[model samples]
Target: MLPETVLRTDDVAPDIRFDVWREAMAATMSPMHISSPHSSDFWGHTRLLTLDDVLLWPVAMQASRYRRTAELVRKGDPELYHITLVLPGSGRLKVDHSGRRHLSTVNDLYILNSSQPCDVEVEENELAVAIGVEIPRNNFPPTAERAIGRMLGHRISGQDGFGAVLSPFLSHLVSRNSAHRPSDIPRLKRILLDLVTGLAARELDAEPSLCTETRRRNTFLLMRSYIQRNYHDPGLTPRTVAAAHFISPRQLHRLFEAEGITAAAYIRGRRLAEARRRLADPAQYTTSVQTIAQRCGYTSAAHFSRSFSAAYGMAPREYRELEHRQQLDTELRSLAPPATAGRDPIPA
Candidate 1:
C-alpha cells in the first residue's frame, strides 16, 4: 500500500504531451527545464513512490535533457538532494553540476541539489532508464555535512562497499512496487537514511554528530542491515558479526535486548523466512530443496528439513509442492490471465 502515482504522456494529447510531462515532473519533483528531440510527441512513463518524506522515482523516457537552471534555483528552492542510479547500458547518463560533468557508469550514482543549478542528459540510446530518489538536504546531520558536501556532483560507486549493498536494496525495493504493505513504505525512510548515513560516514571518515541514544539507534540499524546482506554466509554468527563492526558479542546481545530476541535467534528467523520465500516463488519451482537450503546457509538437508517443519509445519519439499499446486489451482480458476501486479515500470 505504498503511496504512489503513475505519470505518463498518454494522459495528454500527443501535441501537448511534452508540456504536460514537464509540468508533472516539476510538480512531483522540482522546477526544471526538460527538452528532447521527441518533445513534439514525447513518450515517457514513470512511477513515483513516496516513502515518508523521501521520494523514489523510477523514470523511463526517450532520451531527454533535464536542467535546473540557476535562475530557476533562485526563483524557488526545494532544499532537496536528488540521487540517481543508472543501470548498465550501452548509452551514457551525464550530470553537470558545479561546473563539472560526471559520466555515469553501470553502477554509478550522482547527487544533484535543488538549490543549485545542474544539467542531466541521456545520450546514445533510444530509451533511457534510471532510478532516482529525492531526499531532503536537511536530513544530513550537521556533523557530517562537510563530508556530504564534498560528495555533491561526484560519482558514488554503487559497485563498492556500502554502495554495493545499498544499490541492491534499492533495486529490490523498487522491483517490489506496490506489493509492499503500508507499514513497509513508511519504514523505508529510516532504512534508506540509515544506509546512506553509514555509507557517507564510512566513505568520508567522518562520524555523525549524534547523541548517545541516536548513536545506539543508528548502530542497531547498521548491524541489522549488515546481517541482511550477509545472511547467506554460514559463518555469520554473533561473534563474527560483532567483530566485523568492531563490537563485542556481548555488546551485540545488549543491542537486541529491546526487541526481546537474541542475535542468534534473529539470524535464524531471517534465514528461515528467506528459505520459505524461495520455496513459494514460482520462478524457483524447479530448484531443489537441498540447494535452496544450502543457499540459505543450511549445511545439512536433514537439519534444514527439521527446522522448516518445526517453523512452518511442513518439510521444505512439501511446502514447495503445496505452493506449486496452489498456483496451478489459481491458474485453473482464473484461466491463467496475465500478471497484473508486482511489476517494475522501469526495469533495471
Candidate 2:
C-alpha cells in the first residue's frame, strides 16, 4: 500500500488547534507564518501522500493568510516547487510569487518555489478545497526550468489545456490512493513527473524540448481527458477519439497497450464509472434509469442494464433503488439520537 498520513483539527481543542496545525506544517514543509481570523478555532484537513521524493497533499481549510518571508527562506529552504489547484470553494485565494500577486478562483492553479518568498491569502469565512503537490526542484526536467520560472506568477486554468488533465490527475491519485499497491509507486511517480514537466513546458510553447517519452505520455493523458469530457456523447469511441487527435486507430491502441489496457476497454470503463456515479447520487435518484443510461452514453436501456449488472453486480434500476435505501437508512440513523452512540452529545 502507498504510505500516507491524515492531519485533522477535529480532535484537537479549538484554542490550540491552529498551533498544532502550524507545527505540523513546519515539519511537513518549510516553516511559514500563518494567520487567520478563525485561528482560535481554526479548521483544516489535509491528507499527505508520500510518492517517493514527491509529496501530494489534498487540503480543505478555513480562510487564512500564509507567508514565507525571505527570513524564513534563509533559515531553511526545502528547494521544492509547490503546485496548488483550487478544487472548489467560495471567495478567492491570492498568491504572490516571484514578485507578482495573482488571484485564483475555483479550478485555478498556481506555482510557488521554496527558494523565493511568497504570500498567500485565503478569504475569510470561506473553506477552500485544493490539491497541492510538492516536488524537489531537481525532479523537474532541465528543459522546463526556464519556462516554469517564467510561469510561476501566472494563473493556469485547471479547466482547460494541460491543467485540465493535471488537476484531475492529482485529485484522483490522492482520492484513489488506497487502490494502488506498492508495486504501482514507480509508475505513478513517472506519470506525475511527466505531467508536471510536460505541462510547464507546453504552457510556454516549449513542447519540442521535452523528450519523446514525456511527449507520448502527455498525448495519452490529453486523449484520456478528451474522452472523459465527451463520454456523454454516444459516438465517443476509440476510433473516433484517435481521429480527433489526428492519430490512427492502431496508434491509439498502442498508447493504451503501454499501460496494460486497451483503448476500447478504457472508453467503456469510463462510461461505466460515470453511470455508477450517477446511480449512487441522491440528486440523480429521481431521474429514470433509462435517462441516466442515455445520459451516460448508452443508446439502449437494455444494453445499459446488462453492462451495469456485469460491472457492478446489479441492474441499473436495482442499483439506484439500493442506493436510495442505503441513503434513507443513513439519514434515519443520523436523526436517531440513539444511534449516535460513538459521537459526542451536543454541549449543554
Q: Return the top candidate by TM-score.
A: 1
Clashes of 2: 0
Using all chains and alpha carbons, the TM-scores for the candidates as numbered come to 0.84, 0.80
Put down candidate 1 lDDT per residue, 41-159, tens digits, no spaces.
89888898888788888877888888999899999988987888887542578789867788886788777778889998888345677788889988877655555666778888986
Residue 178 of model 2 has an lDDT of 82
Candidate 1, 271: how far from true, in Å?
2.2
Could you give candidate 2's per-residue lDDT for residues 1-348 as a string of tens digits?
679999999989888999999887766667899888988888999988988988898889999888999999999999988898898664689889898988999999898888899888888778878888888889876777766888886889988878888888888898898899988988998888888777788788888888888888998998889998999999999989999988999999889898799988888899999999998999988888889889989899999888889988988888888888999999998998764468787899
Of candidate 2, the 10-residue stretch with the lowest lDDT total is 337-346
- Would you list the clashing residue pairs of candidate 1? none
Q: TM-score of predicted model 2?
A: 0.80
Q: In order, what lDDT does every prediction score?
A: 0.81, 0.87
Q: RMSD, each candidate, Å?
A: 7.3, 5.6
